[model samples]
Target chain A: MLAELMLSALLLLVTYWFIVTRRLSSAVSAYSVQSWLLGLVALALYVDTRLIGLLLFGLLIVSVKGILIPRLLRNRVAFALVAGRETSYYVRFPTALLIGAGLSLVGLLAATRLAFQPQLLPQSVLGISLAVFLLGLFTTIARRDAILQVTGLLAAENGLLLLSLVVAPGLSLLIEVAIVLDVLIAVLVMGFLVARMRDAVAGTDTSELTRLRG
Target chain B: MIDPALLLVMLATPLLGGISSALVRSDRVRYALVVPTCLVTLALALTLIARILATGPVSAFANWLYLDDLDAVVLLVVVVVSTLAGAYSIAYFRSDAQGHVLRPGELRKYFGLFHLFTFTMVLATVSGNLILLWTGVTATTFAAAPLVDFYGSHEPLEAAWKFLVLAVAGELIALLGFLLLYEAGIASLGSAYNFSIPVMEQAGPHLTASLGAIAFLMVLVGFGAKAGLAPMHTWLPDAHSQAPAPVCAMLSGAELNCAMLAIVRVLSLVTPANKARAGGLHEALLAFGLLSMAVGVVFLISQRNFKRLLAYSSVEQMGLIAAGFGIGAPVAAVGALLQMITHSLAKSLMFFNSGNLLLRFRTTTISEVRGAIRVAPASAILVIAGALAIAGAPPFGLFISEFTIIRGALLNHAWAVGAGIAALLMVAFLALMEPFNRMVFGQGRGEPLPARAELGLGVLAPGYILLAAVLVLGVWIPGPLHSMLVGASQVVDR
Candidate 1:
């Protein structure tokens, strides 16, 4: 349990770094690392319980979400009409870092108050998951670029996965599959949309579709 | 003695038809295909409805698939609306630029996706488990998104993307709410994790008060979105206005009904203990319902685009349903169900009529779509009647249903009922009157359309039948359906 806590804490740190900083590659790498550790935990759970479903699910995550998706996105970024560099956010880097630290601290304090088997994950994991969810939503609203918003969307889904780990044990194999499928489909559809948007107009700022302004 | 296997077949048929539509290469043949398929599905759905009403919520197809009095009522609406819209799409698409612009494969994609969307909605309503129901909605949205972008134009694409993002995000929040609901269910049913609505309703009072309240609010947000109620209804206008007319009808008429049915499904499960402490849940629904009505009306009053106006009417109608359900009285709930039926017909008629308008004018701008009485008198009359019916003017089914809702609202919760009905009436009245006035009275300046621009055969027939059905339901609901409605309403809550 303590080992799982350590791993979760590590993930929280990386997720924070990914969302707080404005670098595109950093956010992508952070999520991929998060996925890597998630596979580890799944593997551990599989070994402990001998639930073959866990092994299959873990492999599914490793191959599809971690490897295949990231590769597809990197290729799209290099070849597709992506704008230069990463987009900036509504808040500054220094302040966002402070805020992230505060969120982690608050999550830890909240974790201490909760009563769950400490072997699963620390309550602070929920806080970090929630905080990551918030930051993802924050990025979607704050960033001007559609690509950034799409990244925020993926980040939010990451937070959902984190929450699922803490709350549900192994009862929901299909549920997890359904959620991930939706995210994959959403990203693919959004990719097509980004291409179309750039073709129609020169950029991908969605706010410009305000043709029906008050 | 009707077999539930037929119900499963009925649900799956339109989907099969949709798939068949995509495989064919001819636009003309593709256009003709969905009609027979819709009629067959309707016949099967009616059979299912009849059997359920006769036997009382027959176990259809499999153990997980059950249709109670509530499901019977909702299923009827879904079948009726989809059939009509399928017919309308034939005419609606061919007259527009898409008929010429669409590659043969794209036509199949649209029709295939259309049936896929219908399949998910049916799966959602018929499923006995809450998880399956939720997943069904999610699947439906994915299936429907491509339909929203079927025009393959930039605006439609963007709208479809935005709609998917907003809806899926709201659904995730709803799932969080569902998790809370599961927690409460655990507290009540003692860790069995039963997902059936009937099982949960019996187990509800044992659940924690705070947990139930949280779940209630979460449902309101989640289903409230698909219901197209305020604060979460950002996608309706853009998607509806941008989608093809028949697609608009499906979205406005059937899709929203399915969402509202979901909320009521959960409501049926919430224990009286929850309702007693959470007195304000109904009030919150009322608030959102009224907000939806007022917002839809305000937008409708100012709108120039015909399809967008219809989209707003959906908001108004959904609000009325919410108001009816919010009152939570058996009488009020029945009224809400009636509202669902009437609104489906009236709204579809409005869209079909608008389909004709777009057919003639080649533009959806209300300001430019005038003198329809001269343009195509038959379609013009249908548009005017549709407008009047949706506005709840007398003789139309919506008028009867709205009257019932307001009357029931006055009886059960007088003050809220009176004020909500008045506000709704005012907005809906103005809403239907304004754009329709332009459609019927204003000078239409566009050139006469070619014969190809006229209403197509595959499209015009289903919409007319739907209009007839709406008229039939308005004047008189058959005994079996009415009996089911009463049974379902009584089971709502005391």
Candidate 2:
């Protein structure tokens, strides 16, 4: 249990890095590391439950999310940054970090207030899961580059899965597979779009997309 | 007894057809394949509805696949719109190819994704489990994203990107809500019960009110985003306006219903738990509804692009339907469902009309094109009729549904809301008419369209059929359909 908490703390740290980082590639790397930790956490859960489904889920997470997706995102960032270093945050770094910290606190408070079944899971898991979730959302909103936003989105999904695993460990295999595959396809589509945006408009920054607005 | 195997066939036909469309080499062969596949799928859906009416409801695969009155209503709308749009795509793309707007090779990609989009929506409508339903919605974003970016240009790509990001973010929240509800379920009913709709409904009263309310609100916000409710509806206009017209029609017409159906399923599960808390849910929905309508009308007044204008109008129509659902009266629920059907029909026809104009005039700006009636008389008339029908003019189905919604609001002692909706509808009508009149009757600014400009029957047939259905539904609903509406309303009614 202490090991699990330690890994979660490391995961939170990586999420904070997502907020402070300005380079799109760094943010992407932070996201990949965060996903690796998430896979580790899933492996820990599998060790406890001895469920082969969780074991396979952990392996898939590490491979698909931690390895495959980051490689895809890196290719996007590599060609994308050749033009110039891009500013990814609308809010200033300090202010965005402060806001992200507050969001994390709110998550903790809200999680504690919920009447979760006590015998089934530890309370801290719920609070930490929510904090991770909120931080990811903050990252998405704060980032201007579309790739970082996709990274932020993946982090948020990781947080949700953390909460779900603790609260409902018995979720059917079908749902787990569906959730993973859904995220995978979403990332693939976003990667394709970002690549296309770079090739067509010369940048992956969403601010460039102001041609049609009411 | 109905054969349960038929449901599998309904689901498989689209999947196989979509795959085959992608693999086929010849565009002509692909187009031919698309129409027949759509027809078969439509037949299967109609048969499913008939069997559901006959057998009450059908559950298969341990309740993983289910069909009830609510599913049938939504299924009927999807099949009708998809069938029309699939048939219409042939002529629509042919014009684009001829005009050099799109290459002939791109038609294969468009047709393939079109069928895939239809299949995802169909899966969402029929799936019995909430998770599977969520899966269906997620798949829709993936399938439709490419379709939206069919042009592979800057504008369409940007629009498709926003559509993907916003939709994924919103749906993830809904997933969190589902997790929370699952936690609540385990707390109440133990772990044996799964996340199937029937199972959740059975265990509804045992769910804690506080948790259920939160879950419902999450659903309203999340699914509401996909439904193009305001604030989260940022993706709607960009994606709708930039997509090829037939794709836009599917996105605006059938896709929004699938999202709303998700919200309805969640509401039903929560309502049985606590009556007053459920009212809170309704109040939240009502607030979003009004806000969406207000925001939509404001944009409608100033929108320059005709396609985006239609997108904002869709926001208004969806907002009205959301208000109907929020009122939670059986009458309002019926109106909401009816408006969904009518909006799908009228909105698709209007979009197809816009497509015709775009092909002829080569522009989407209302101010740029003038004296449309003199160029293509048939298209001009169709656009005018569609404009009138969508504006809730009498003798159209939207008019009836809007009236039903107002009466339901009044029945709920929401006179102010009723008045507000009525005023907004008038403002929307004026906004729409101002632009539509300019395009149809205003003096030409450039050379008149070629005297030979004419519409093929294949192109007009689907839209004509839709307008006729909307007109007929205004004055009359067949017995089976009426019963279906009542049954669906009961599912959501208190």
Q: Each prediction's TM-score against the native?
A: 0.90, 0.96
What is candidate 1's TM-score for chain B alone? 0.93
Candidate 1 TM-score to native:
0.90
The fnat of each candidate, in order, is: 0.07, 0.62
* Candidate 1 pairs with clashing backbones: A1-A119, B87-B459
Candidate 2 lDDT at A6 equals 75
What is candidate 2's lDDT per residue for B50-111, written digit by digit as tens? 88787677888878888888888889989999999998888888776325576766877788
Query: How does candidate 2 fare on TM-score?
Result: 0.96
Per-residue C-alpha lDDT of model 1 across residues A1-214, encoded as one tens digit per residue: 6665576667666666655655555556666777777666666667766777667767767776777666666666533323343444466777766766676566456445433332245567666666666666656666666666777767666765666666554435665676677677766666666766666555666766555421
For candidate 2 chain B, which ten residues in a row score worst on lDDT? Answer: B96-105
Go through the candidates in order and give each one's DockQ.
0.31, 0.68
Question: What is the docking quality class of candidate 1?
Answer: acceptable
Computed on C-alpha atoms, the DockQ of candidate 2 is 0.68
- Candidate 1 residue lDDT tens string, B1-494: 35667867876887788788878878777777777888898898787777777777666322356677777677778878888788777656665543346565777788888888788778777877676677776677777778887777677876787787777776666666565566565554554355566666667677666656666787788778877998788788889888877788888878888777777776666646575664677777777887888787777777777788888888878988898888766777888888888888888778777767766777888776667777566676677777878888777788778877787777875776667677768766976787787778675566553343334555566656766777777788788768988988866663
List of clashing residue pairs for candidate 2:
none
